[model samples]
Target chain A: MITKDELLQIIYKAVADFNSMQDVDEQLAQQANQVLFSRPGFTKEGLLDSMGLVNFLVTLDDWLDQQESAQSLHFDISDALENKEEALLTIDSLANYILLKNKKV
Target chain B: MSIKNSHILILSDTNQSNFSSYLSKYIKDAKVVTTPFNQLMQVLINPTHAVWQQHYALIIFWANPKSLFPDLEKTLIGKHEMLHVKNFFLRLIDKAERVLFTGFENYPNGFYSQFENISSHNRYALNMMLTSISMESPGVVSYLPGYYSPVVKGLHAVSEDLWYLSKTAWHRTVTDRMASFVADMWKQWHGLSVKLIITDLDDTLWGGIVGDDGWEQLRLGGHDAVGESFSDTQQQLLIWKKRGILLAIASKNDEETALQAIDRHPEMKLRKADFSTWRINWEDKALNIQSIITELNIGAQHTLFMDDNPVERYRVAQAFPDMIVPNLPANKLEVPAFLRSLSCIPATGVLTNEDMHRAELYVAEQQRKNSMTAFSGIDEWIQSLNTVVSIEKLSHQNLTRAAQLLNKTNQMNLRTRRLSEDALWNWSQTPGQAFYTAHVHDKFGDAGLTGLIGVSIHDDELFVEDFVLSCRVMGRGIEETLMNFIISLMTEWQLSNVKVACLLTPKNKPCRDFFSRYLLSDSHEWVFDSKARFVVSGIQCNVIDFN
Candidate 1:
């Protein structure tokens, strides 16, 4: 089973990878344990472009799927991002949401 | 730093947004613009498309032939489609400064001939055709096998969900590595590559230290596993040497002892002759590396250091942060493969005849230096050597190497201009501008094509846009010889005054120093009277007719 701290670290790693790809102005990626602070119009304002969202979500989901505890439990990843109208609010919210879906936890 | 005025276009038939993101991350500075998804054919066949209006420094055709040719299973239809693609691609290559195309089909329609799978052969055929076209393309088009390296036989390369949701063919885990490979490919094309590899001797190069174990006890090639692995490391370094990477030693040992081990070892894959230079003394490895770098006249960023000792590796890394100091795998058995996988190793691309004789060229430079003691003055030494220089109008035969020199020559460059072969040729086509290449041969040996000077005429004052000479032939009166040719060119044009467009850069102080003789009072500009003699004695020049 994955712990909350471990999951946050993975997300932070994905953020670092994301920041490496993005310019300074486009770096909405905060440090680990730091709030992501995404709103509805974040993508519209060009803080994070369409591709950045795809890369971030895909990177996060790939790590979650690789966890041994999540092997049998198919993650409800579509709902994780398909709530597209309401994008990521904070780093903690997504961590809490993933933990809820992880039955082993 | 971003390459000045580098505009890259990603032309893909599949959704390459992730590839673009990864590319932007990897290349960092270049302005990357990705076209709409699956619109490659429209951009390729349509000249009026927005892509054609603006020129690109590089164009990547990331493709998915499965989508491009849905009729691949049908023989006649596929044949027609292939013929159409071939014809238009040739036209497309004419428009790009340099083009990087898909070397493999990333997401084949089906696995190739696996377990009763019949239709996948067409995808394999598609791959083979792309490779064939990339090989024979008249322009600078190279198929990209870079991204495919980190991928293990296409395993985990693609995810069905990502493909369905976003249409990105490559998995996110793999894109970062892919981006690095692409960046290396681009950097190598500009002659920015790791030129020298400094390796440690003790446990890094062999199984045991030469001074302690003695030559007879050192583990190199033999029947044993450890001995074979040690020899394997040497073989890998030898391959890099054959690829034009100069090998040098930086170890804490007696120079003669190390050389003796290299000379006397029965199965040593590397020889004393293979190393261009070395600093095998009991000093700080970083200082030793710096000495070798000074002797070789290459930047630290263009060097790679390999050492098994953690402290030595860290020390060198701290000394030269830009140098590629790879941490050899802890397991000795894995060392060879890990060394082979380093991205800083010289790319197989851009290898010319000059590359094959690069070490010999360095040795020739050393010999020229060695004989310096025999002469009273530098001029006398230069006069002693019978030097002949051939200046040719830019032609296809020498265009590739000329561009390489224009990019590689940093110290002797006037403007520090870097351009691809096609870009250089394109600039020459503009009115009042011409570029000439200089090839030098002396009593010592051939220096190949080592100099370039681009000039433009504006109101009778010949403005020298670029004046570059390779370091190998520097200080040998080649600069004066090239300058003399330029002055003669001015006389032929009936122009009396000449101005150099020299830009002072951190590495280009040598250029400013050389042009100081012609510097106008107080200003950085160098204006010369073309009527005055500017010839180097004991040198013969041949300038081809320029159109």
Candidate 2:
């Protein structure tokens, strides 16, 4: 089983990789709480819009699927987006949701 | 940095700043020029626009018909307008070297619920028509679907919030994906492919070190799962070799021990004869790779190095940043997936007869090198080689190889003009344009078609558009013989003068030096007066007419 710190690092690395390809603002992507700031509900002036949220979710889901411990952990971001679930809003919530799904929480 | 002297023009309905930014990430020197948002018609009508004046390596048209023509389903006038737009884009394709047309992303549910069925059907028809047109005109037109509809549903490819906020319809992921796709197409069209794969031994090739485990005990080519995975990796390397990619070994081990395993192992899929060369000694792996690349006479940019040890891979990557050094997977089971993921292995739809026989040609070159020491004088060696040069007009059979040579050959190329295969064919078909390919062979073996010359006749004067010789045949007097042949052809055609285009590029210094010594030139044009006696005395090669 993967620890929360390792999972956080994985999420951070994925965001970094995705940002490397995108034209995202360096200030938002380079922050320690980038995932939180990227949330649609975090602030009215949040850096990431709906598309950015979707991309981050998809990328995080893919990273989780590739991990040996979380091989069976499959979270559908499209479904979550459609349902307007609060768990998909912030990085901490999303990671906790994924952990809950994997029975690690 | 983008590719030097390359430009890409983008015409899209939405603001293309994001797309342009993503594309620039992949293509270092590419100058990307995007039309003003939704101003496609204005640019299309005015040929004097600065965008139209520049030579674009690629022209991209990204517009959703549904968004561009909102009333298409309700009115016939909208359909007619779309047809006019399509015709305008087709005309632009004729003017440009390569054009990429993107299909519409599927409409989200709330946007146009009433005309959903009709809109979907029309988009499918549009994509099919574009695909058929692209097929008929290979290397010129490429149609890419905006989204894989079945795989991605509900949200469509466009982000609603971003579209409202910034007028950027396509999502960041879509833009990123398109960037990669365009980069691949550019690489393929230019014949910038990985030619060589240098691999390590021990943990990379097998589970155990050969020196410690001995030939029989090494975990390779056995019923055990670990051994089978190693064998599977070797099989994959062999498959790549068959695809015309040259393979070599750069490992730190006893030469005799490694050779013994490769030569005598019952389960070894790869043998000692498989590799073009091997450097199996306690030397710096980076230096070994350098020696291999130098010995093969290939550019470092066209080589890929693989090793299991991360330190070695890092050292090689640091030494030669241009060389591809893929990180090896920790689990051996992931090796096959890792190998398949490499973009360097896939052929760019331009495989030629010469590419298939590359290994044999290199071996033949080695044989020629061995025979060189036997002859005391250079002239004697040239005379005794029994060299035959066969010149033939470019045709469908050799078109791929001819285009590959034209795009990839730089050192001895006169003009260094890279043309797409379709563009080259179109140029060759022009009236009064003549192109010839030279096939070289000696007593040692067939060197295959290694030289190309293109000329155009205007007002009784022959203009040399392209004159390129393969660097493999550089030291020989083949260039002089090719020039003599051209002069003879000009004489036969009753041309007054032969003018060579002497466009100098950074890499074609050798070609410039050759012209400076032989052809009399004033600034840019190298002229050969028809009345002047062009001596072709000392070349012992026979020029055969190949129709």
Candidate 3:
């Protein structure tokens, strides 16, 4: 199973990747870490729009697949995007969900 | 090269936000927008629509041929024709000022390569039709090179996952590579391509330093591996030269000894005549490069300097940051491949007769300069060469070469209205525009199509559109002859006013100074009185009737 620190580091890298394409103003406006990973139910409070969320998630998905232990693990946020949207509200919750999914495997 | 804040519109059937994202990353300051998905045909058909109002400098139309043709399998087997697809894209030629039509790759068709080897029939008919689109369109449309590019790098163009996920046909890498390609091509089209390459003679050109190793020991073409590598490097440089890139040497060595090595070296593929000029001394490479480019009349931005020593490279690189100073591979064997990989200058283009023989033209220029010393005075020297200039209105036959002069001339340009051949052709078709070309020849050699004069005639008044002369024949009386032709034109037509349009550029100060005598006021337009008798001397000028 992946450690929490490893998972958090991946999120940080994904955030940097996301910020690479963003303007400085957008980067500042969307303090992804403050709004995200701030609380369990912070989806509506985050600055990421629908496309931004999908883009960031897709980018994060691509990076995760390149990891050593990812082993064809897909970045499917269907459950979070569906009924359990709060699972993606915070970085900790997302990390726990990923850990839970990997442990199930 | 500075990327002009050009607005670019992406017209494609599929989602090309990836294209916009890449262009945003690479083509800084340029605004890139994609039309709504499935709006390619609508955008192409309705060019005057609101989306086209973005004033896009370029419209990249990338659509998969299979998707466009629907019956691609039948088309490949010759069961169905691809004319409708061709005409649909051809109509887009005049739709925008510039449309970069990214050609379709040989994919699903490429999968049938095993069958292609056994049969004589070609499977890549789609690629051919796409090329024809660019050919018919000319200046208004450009074809992105599809084969053997830096972008191709053995990567699969289509991503299955992306195709399934979001209908994005290609991978992100394709977008990135195409962005770079477009930027480079854009710069080249705007006259920012490399015109000259200045190289070091010692370790850069050959394997060993000629000064330290002596003439006989220099590793150039020979049986040894290092020697062969140097020979390969020379071969690469020769290719660039043949493609119209002028080569010069800037080295720290005795002129006599180094030249002797260059001449006496039996295995040398290059000779003294190959270089336009050389700077061989203990002087700084930076200064030598400066002198070489200055003597040749090329902008520093249009030059590339190469040296094996990093210190020398760094010094020159720092001095001229705009100049291309490739950090050559440390491994001697790798230098040739590295240099070969550079696409700074477009590798593929229609090479005119002038382009193919450019090195010899420069050599002839050197001869002309040398002959200048033989005469007692500058006037006597100018009269001695027996210079004859043939002038004719720019026609379809000589349009390409004249367009070259139109775009390339820097110092002697009057207005510097640089234009592509197709644009120039379209402009010349205007009822009032009269564009003329000057072909110079003398005792030295034929300087093919070295001057251009374009003007717009309105009733009794005339406006000079473009008056440009190549540096090869700058100081000669060609400009005066061309000017005299304009005056004679005014006399023949009985015009009241003649205004020469002049725009000041950093390199075009020569033009400003030339027009200073003709100017009545501070206006860059040097207005001339038509009734004055302006006689041209020292040139046997012949004006061909232009119909």
Candidate 4:
């Protein structure tokens, strides 16, 4: 399970990391999330619509790939974000997603 | 830097050959992952594919022709593709360093159509949008027009023309226009102001050697024919001087002859008064240029040197690669047009008060130097001008100048980090971000927006992320005023142990000594916490109102 806030944190960090950002602390990270998510529902897709999300995701993926003994997994977090069917959405979900996918090996 | 950890994910359907493999050979840092073109939406949605994001620095998005537009079943011509491709480019402009347009090699029949379509009226709008984005962000979006490469010959048709025409039109076009435009989209980028135009007097400015030919016989100053062309060039140079470009002449001739021709010749437009410096000596031209650069306290890149003599031009070019050496036409008739193009048209915006006072400022500097030679102490020199510092919290009015200072102020810049307008806007929106501008004025002139600093607060720790001051205002005690102001702000807020870090840059050695100089504080790279110490000095006086 991954919550929107957690997903956003990862996304924000990813974007910052991709940019070689040195001092994007929690405060700036929160603002970045707000900027992307603050708009009305109409612009929610706009937040992740263009290169911003792509760059962020790409950066996150690169960092994760650098981890020793990297793992890959699939976990359905859409249920948590969209349906609100699950309450747990944190950095743990991201870790578990990789763990679960690697379990197939 | 080996890109071993990097990966590139290409989303394309064409089986023409694995372009990813081709890219892989060139780019070895990241593994290349090529997925079938239509699977974009699915791949993005798939949580498993997130691995691609973690492994790659770049994502080459090759649009799948089939899934993107199903209605156009037949091979879409370049125009039709471009109409759609334009949307695709706009969509991805935010993500990539540059988007390379390709298709001519594989599909030549439709290439011209795509090129023409992209070059149509919509091209201007696209260029405008790209330029607008560049203005806003810096280094974030660049479109490699399809015509840039033979295999991808479409959008570049216009860009190439635009690049060439800008020079022909006598406009100071953007340098590294497309790449810089994109880089500017994400960061603040700077351009050198062509302040001083240094020229040779004999063949460069007018036709004849004044030392040998004398005023009357010297092929200058007349409406007859060749002399008329010489006067035209002089008039153009005079126009530039009036517009605030500093004019200087370095001629190896008897100074009296030049004075006589300029003073007595009826057709002469450029006179002795127009030049800021006249190095009319038999010394080496290169040495004279070196003296000019030192006297102005500007970089070689900011000076444009012109000489009709090929050997002289070669000598200067070899010595200073950065100095602009426009080709001097062999024929005198072409001199006027060449000089006309050499005139600097100031950046596309309104001129500032400081810009208008630049000539006065330089003159004041000369006066200050002459006084310094007569004065006994350094303090006497500084005190002579009655310098005053005025600090103002950042505002919209001076944001552009603030950005300029952050990007261009090198020697005294602490952290030496360049930021884009979008980044600044984002920072303003962020919590705990503080920005301020400082203006210094003395008896000489107003050094406008002389300094800028950006600070961020996290928990109890305050971070001085950027501190920069313009070179023009460096010698004055402005930095002390800025540091004192920062400490005063912290005292007012009751914040403790304020930490300031100075990042090393190619041109920022002066900044490394900042804290040590005025504050007598130690700096370290460890994550700054509340325990850090910043001793505040209590000496203040004479605050001038610059607002």
Q: Where does candidate 2 clash, by residue pair?
A: B1-B28, B1-B29, B2-B28, B2-B29, B2-B30, B3-B29
The per-model lDDT (C-alpha) reads 0.75, 0.74, 0.73, 0.55
Candidate 2's displacement at residue B368, Å, is: 1.7
**Model 2: per-residue Cα lDDT at residue B382:** 68
Q: How well is candidate 4 docked (DockQ)?
A: 0.01
Q: Write the per-residue lDDT of candidate 1 for residues A4-94, one digit (tens) a residue.
A: 7877777776677667666676775554334343555554233444555666677666766776644454455467666643335566776
User: By TM-score, how accurate is candidate 4?
Assistant: 0.57
TM-scores of the candidates in the order shown: 0.88, 0.74, 0.81, 0.57
lDDT for position B527 in model 3: 74
Candidate 2 residue B322 Cα shift, in angstroms, is 1.4
- DockQ values, each candidate: 0.38, 0.13, 0.18, 0.01
User: What TM-score number comes out for model 2?
Assistant: 0.74
What pairs collide in candidate 1?
none
Candidate 3, which segments miss by more than 4 Å at Cα? Answer: A1-105, B1-9, B24-33, B45-59, B73-80, B96-100, B106-123, B132-150, B154-168, B215-226, B370-381, B504-507, B533-536
lDDT of 2 by residue, B1-547 (tens): 1147588998876778778877887777688889887676678778888778886778898865654456655554445665665676678776677888876555555543432433555666677667766876766787766544422333236555446545676666667667766776677666566888999989888889899889889898667888889998999898888877889999999999999999988988998878988999999999999999987888788898989999999999999999888898989988976786565565335467887888778777777877889999776776677777778788888887898899888889888877777778889889888788888988888888899999889898888888999887776667877887788778888888888777887788888887776655435567787665444344554545422
Candidate 4 local lDDT, residue B306: 82
Model 2, chain B only, scores a TM-score of 0.81
* Top of the candidates by TM-score: 1
Per-residue lDDT tens digits for candidate 4, residues A1-105, read: 434454445545655554432212322233432433222444433333222322233345544444433323233333223322121222333344444444654
Ranking by lDDT: 1, 2, 3, 4
- Residue B493, candidate 2: Cα error in Å is 2.9
